[model samples]
Target: MTSAALSFRYVGDSGMDETMNQQLLIDNGLPNSLAPVLSFKALDETHHVLPDVKVSTVFGSDRGNLVVPYGGSYDILRFSGPGKHDVTDVRVTVQRKTEARNPAGSHDVTTQALDSHGRAIEKFERFSAVRLINEDNFPVFVRIAYILWDQPPKGVTQQAVEVTPIGGLTSVPAHGTAVVKVSGKAAAAVARNSYGPAVSIKAYNSQ
Candidate 1:
């Protein structure tokens, strides 16, 4: 399955020297049918330290596995260090249908970002993409949402932004391909920013 890598960097103005303790939250708008796995890394060893990762359900009953509720939030990463720090790569993988089912069918859905040239860009914190995938014999639907936080110039204060869904609800026909482009915008602007949109795909039997 195709997954998107969210990227971020830290740049401080001159004479700005201080330690930064920050938490990055990712919201999963999809139902429990799709499970999200997040992996983080630092590209430049000298610039930043390896981040601490954690996953928890924001809503719904705890199903043992990391199952974020529909339109629920989860903490993806936490970073604490001094000076300018940059978290290079944050990869997100969505696993379809974690629980076993009778007469198992296709439950695969992935997300990726392409530049204006159609080339895959993995080094970006803010990006947009068109998701294309083939549906199995089972009918399916997709939903997406996003949250953004922009950090201040020096302090740790952050401003929250509202993210709008580019494409509304989408339906996937059985044994057919479906395509949709999703994008988001920050409510307010800040110097250092970190955020991403969440996607959810649910499968249902055709009646």
Candidate 2:
């Protein structure tokens, strides 16, 4: 099966909409890690990534850091056929909220590539996972660009998803617990709470 684009969906949040707010930026001006070791671009001249290391997101689910695409069902996005040219690659910008300093919020996300073709690219590339790492005291309100699921999600908007704008800062935060793999071109970076606006996530048809 092949998925076009994917977003997140929350099942049990009272007084709040089921779909979580996210600022999606998919398949637009991003690098692909599956482009072979000699061809794949380096993160930066100064920054470097380690091999076979794991980072924890402390997510509140069984799938851990992969809460976005996998949710709580399974791991890996079983893919079949299709070459490298037919894939959608993008980065998951994780914005952390820094209440004390910036009031708006800050984010600690990675500079990794997420594949939307519903297939893993040698474990370095992500298809069914959006890894988040929060090094803050308070929990972060996740607003990822999208989700690439292992299986087609049920009872969702299907067409596209709309997220509510956070007024001043709500008590309700995004889901937690994610395990990030620190390998290949994967590295960490920080972004302010300038998530701009919550964009609509058009559901991808897994053909």
Candidate 3:
């Protein structure tokens, strides 16, 4: 922990989860300015990068709190992205099959689509999430958690999915990749972030 480690959440799946009774614990030592991008992978003792066990990154920002469990290093790439900044923490969120969700935190904006002129053209309300589909012959279990918010989507119908997280750089065994769904728009009311975008969009004017 560093000098900036004052604010963080700690609500474990605490008693509801099992103890991995393993050696080599992994701790999050990043400064408050940065957080783990997404979950991580853990391999088996054989040191076989191709085939091994897996452990997920920490749970929600409320839970695990950036610190990982018995396994290798955390996945910094998932937490840090090109366009994403000013994030406290990040985690992979999934729900029951086929239900579009909302952004759990302020950082959970679905990546907006851009036209030739680099303009956003989304109609319905959009939220970002990580979706994983199994395309392999065997069943693969992934460890993931809900978004930063404990509250369910205000008016959407959905259920949570239980996954088995993996540690190490690679996942245990799965034929899939992380497909993110996030979106962001200028908050007209906020003077700092939206002044430029809102002006061009004609949504609001400082004059």
Global lDDT scores for all candidate models: 0.35, 0.23, 0.24
Q: Which sequence of candidate numbers ranks them by TM-score, best first?
A: 1, 2, 3
TM-score winner among the candidates? 1
Write one digit per residue (lDDT tens) for candidate 1, span 57-90. Answer: 2111123223333333333233335322444333
lDDT at 188, model 3: 19
Name the 10 consecutive residues with the lowest summed lDDT in model 2: 32-41
Candidate 2 C-alpha lDDT tens digits along 129-200: 344444445453333323222222443212112211111111212334343322222222111111332222
Output the TM-score of candidate 2: 0.19
CA lDDT of 185 in candidate 2? Answer: 25
Error of 3 at 141 (Å): 28
Q: List candidate 1 segments past 4 Å from native.
A: 1-108, 123-125, 147-166, 175-177, 183-207
Q: Could you tell me every candidate's TM-score relative to the true structure?
A: 0.31, 0.19, 0.19
